[model samples]
Target: MASSAASVLNRLLQNASRPKKPSQPPPSPSLILHHINSNNFAAAFSALFSIPTPLSIPLYSRLLRISASTRSLVDARHLESHIISTHHPRHPPTFLLNRTIETYAACGSLRDARELFDEMPRRNGGTWNAIISAYASAGHSHDAILLFSRMNKSGSSRPNDVSFACALGSCADLLALLLARQIHCLVLKYGFAKNVILSTSVVDVYGKCGIMSDARKVFDEMRERNAVSWNVIVRRYLEMNEGEEAVILFFTMIVDGVRPLNFTVSNALVACSDVSALKEGCQIHGIAVKLGFDGDHVVENSLMEMYAKNGLLEDARKLFDDSTSRDVVSWTSIISGYALCGRFAEAEKLFDSMPERNVVSWNAMLAGYVRCLCWGKALDFIFLMAKESEEMDNVSLKLILNVCAGVSDLELGKQVHGFVFRHGFCSNIFIGNALVDMYGKCGNLRSAELWFLSMASNRDKISWNALISGYTRHGRSEEALNAFGEMQWETTPNEFTCSTALAACANIFVLRHGKQIHAHMIRNDFNMDVIIQGALVDMYCKCRSIEYAINVFEQATSKDIILWNSMIMGCAYNGRGEFGLELFEMMLKDGTKADNVTFIAILLACITEGYVDLGHRYFNLMSDEFGIIPRVEHYECMIELLGKHGFMVELEDFIERMPFEPTTPMWMRIFDCCREHSYARLGERAERWINESNPLNPVEFNVCSGPAMEPS
Candidate 1:
């Protein structure tokens, strides 16, 4: 294609090398004028050379009046008077001047066009139209409109199709829809609506001005329609997000047997991506292949992005691989696909191999790393991006800062905060939210609150959720509830906020407030979420209402393992040992496998209820049946169970065989049992273990047995 264009240019330059006529005689005045006005350039060239004499030459002036093409080929700047002396010496010179200006205007030399227009011996309607169209075509709409108004003020000829088109184009460029309407009315008044070129230009103008309805009205009124007219309307609809309409219009064009152009098909396919119209997108793809436009880069890029965005990664990859000439945008689309599909390693490898990269390339890499949970790597990439002179704008900063929050990196978070302040991006809403989340995730509520208060705008649900959840996770239950109360005044809490606040409620044991929240959930129709319902059940159980917890648990429509665990643990902790055991058995019967925490609660319940036999059964079942390994707390519960039963010899033997050394509390439990049963030999052994292992007194000991302090 490059060589073809160059060859075309070479031929044009070669045609300019013809030898000039030498001492040619001039032709008859009428004959020369006829030759110049003729449309055929070769015929006019021959007639100009047939002149008989040079001294009495009147042909040059006649030639000037003939054709714009002949005058363009001439180098007669010094022979101007001879031509003028013969032709129209007595007539008004406005026609010749207008012709000269129009010639330059058509040749796209706007400066020369303007110069000729200004230096004309006289100005007229044709001259103003020429200059206005020239300015409009050059994207100098203001100059075009100014000259147009001047023509009207001078009472020159009213605008024809050519003049109206220029004026309307200026209105479109400026988005002056009102001015465009006025031009439309004037064009209608002049009965130029039948002119297909004028009508198409007006449709294009209206479409650009966002008045698609008017554009359609003009389009339907046209007696003759061209491919350009169809493309303009289709593009307008696509831009408006009316993808369905765009597709419908495209098929209508096809049904009318109008072959869809590359741009028209591209517009329709691009619209499919916006609405996720997969069927329509496929149809457009099929049409493109049939029309041989599937190979066009623009159409192919849009197809790749469309399929990628619609969760069709494999299909998108297939299209990308099939592409013959992939540009940077092509690579960006495929990389974004891999990132979105959670294939970060592949995305990163492909990004590294790209021959060249742009801003989109950097952003894609950063976003990919963050999405893959590699926050440290994301931050590293951010520094490299800055060194390469890629500006970290608000979107980039927000992505990296969110990664910081996820990783809970306080040092990196603080440095990013400073970067935000220095770069004047502190006020961006997304960046501010990310900052709040970062401090919250790092267990720094003080910093989080400070940043939250500094935000000028009202908080969104994400902001409130982050603040509330931060407090709950850090054991600041009272503050979490207070933030929840404040958030209610600003915005309604969603299920996530309610669940988080319920967690705080369980910690504080504020039964009154918890009941009120439960009532609010019922009133606001938030009782349907299984997670929130489970939270409500847990909150009720923590507040020491076993019956209410059971009621809420029973009413929950979809009970998951979390709900079952919450109920089991609630019963265990609140002294409903029999009920807790029954619930555990029911959970197993219902095929809900209890996890380690659930088994711990079950064993603790057995110890509290003096069910030593049941505790042994579960301990063995935990290891053998469920294949669950016991942690330290599980061991503690077993010791408590044995010590409560006064099984000293068995407890000692069990402790000796343990994987980890027993803590002082485990021996203390045994010591208290010895004191209760008056076993002096066991008490002496406990005392010796305490005195020799650590001279310092243990902070806590069983109340039943302990030596008194020597002095204060």
Candidate 2:
């Protein structure tokens, strides 16, 4: 039977040997339905192609769904061809064409989707949303935003809530506050103000764009709220590092009787992690357990992160080990947790044992190594990651740039710079800033300036800080001050830049400029965090302005140990040893703990006061009382104190009882001290040791009262 049918069909296909006056039969819709019912969309499409008949709108919509599900560009194109045959070439049904555009986008051929959309003679809100969502989801935020603008101006389509939501999302992604506000106005003008989803999107955009007050206003105005709205507002606070606000909102959500979902619990945990709120995290964990989200993978991972970030590594490890549904995120979180606490060996072990890894996982490990300053291993891991074709994003590049700066690997930094340009990440200002920082720290000031200038209008406070810090770090204090001057003209000085400026002033002893910066900070209401306060004290002290330094220290509302140390050391160095001692007593009374640097200052004070007995007691107190087990610097200060007081036997005994062999600098310091005291015998012995330690650069002191110079 098959052979007979084939032979007859073959005779009919041989160019019709006999002409017949027969009519072409109508196409069978049942055949198309049969193929469709059997779930063979490709075959159904083929049958439709053969018949070339119009399909019902419902059937065409069904076909579009199938094409989109398959995500096959071929299926999309075939369906489009059938649509064109069924309708006018320039005008398919608007709804059908909208779905077609979406199908093309889902197939990842946005160009084809766009061409179809452009060729459409008419469009509706769905048409605009289809393309806008496609671009937004694919991370082309700029293009998506542009399309939304065109849609608004064309007036061909009255965009609905979805269109505004997608546009607002793109605005959030781009941080385009102005466009976000415009879209927000459109949402109101178009009467979508009551839409909860649209409202949440507005809040998200405002929060992400750093207009928190506006975000809060929109959020408060929402007459009705959903879990999504709460989550969006809370997560916005987390993004801004306002962990307290996020946690407060989470509690408010619970009090409002809105039970948190798994992601909600996860976000709350992240907030706790941000603030190191272990008790609150534990409370959330209890809530999760009661809500049955404790077993959820997302909540579990966040729990581990919370514990780890709060330095409860053992608790985190237990959760990691007990997790039953650990995904890649779970693994990455646990790995990052270990790495956060300087346990790289354990982190790498877990990372190696992971079942699957993504770029986040790789970057987390790299960040761990970078944090621990294991520069060589970080470079190796990133290189190996690249060799394995793992996609390196901007974070990885920044880490590599940091490593290059740390190791002064200028050649490698340049290569990474080239990679940045090639990979089209040059527009990322953070990466550009990293490049400048890398070049600056690597001693390539010229490259640093060039990169900074190339940034043009993109230069932010960090760029200026990096340039000025480089000059300050490498002892070009004058240039650093000059750069700071230039920065003041280009942009308002931030706290970091002001701090660097103060340091430059101190280095050059330009008390006038330091006073000006201090006044400017006061006038501008700059963020006078503890760090800036410390810098102010250090600058004033280093410039020999003990009175002014005291004024800054006394005026500071908040003071850390660093500030205390700076004040003490400044007083001691400026010949106010007794007052420096009083400050130390005050530091202790104020509940501030002293470190090794503090004791060094104390020893210096004792030396200035000629209290040899007190210096010995304090040196002993470093180990016996404070448990600071003195470092070589502390020991040197003690020996200098003893030698300056002509306590020869005690200084020699202190050097002999040292835990490690004396270094050239230690011996040189000893020789200078011995010469100061006219202790000739010990001076010659110290000279002998300096010569033995650094033979190439022989010591040339003549036992006279001349200033010491660098060995040559």
Q: Pick the candidate with the highest TM-score.
A: 2
TM-score for each of the candidates: 0.57, 0.83
Which residue pairs in candidate 2 collide? none
- Supply candidate 1's per-residue lDDT for 32: 47
List the candidate 1 regions with Cα displacement exceeding 4 Å.
Answer: 1-320, 325-344, 358-389, 585-594, 608-611, 621-628, 644-650, 663-694, 698-712
lDDT of every model, 2 decimals:
0.78, 0.87
Task: List candidate 2 segments past 4 Å from native.
Answer: 1-31, 49-54, 72-92, 111-147, 375-391, 411-415, 418-425, 489-492, 523-527, 555-559, 589-593, 627-712
How many clashes (backbone atoms < 3 Å, residues ≥3 apart in a chain or on different chains) does model 1 have?
Answer: 4
Tens-place lDDT digits, model 1, residues 1-712? 9999999999988887766568854565466456556655455545544543332333443444343444452423222333344355454355554554555554445776677666565666787887898799879998898888777677757887778889988987888788778778878887998888888888888888777888889999999877877888899888877878888888888888888778888788777877888888888888888988888998898888778867788899899888889899999988987886678788888888888888887787787787777777787887888888455678788887787888787898899899899989877877888888889989999999998988846568788888899899899999999998999888888889889999999998998888887888789987457898789888988999888999988887777888888888888878888888998988889888878888888887887688888888898899898988998888988888887776666676677788987788776776776676555665667767776677787422333544432222
Model 2 TM-score on a 0 to 1 scale: 0.83
Weakest 10 consecutive residues of candidate 2 by summed lDDT: 703-712
Clashing residue pairs for model 1? 25-51, 25-53, 26-51, 61-83
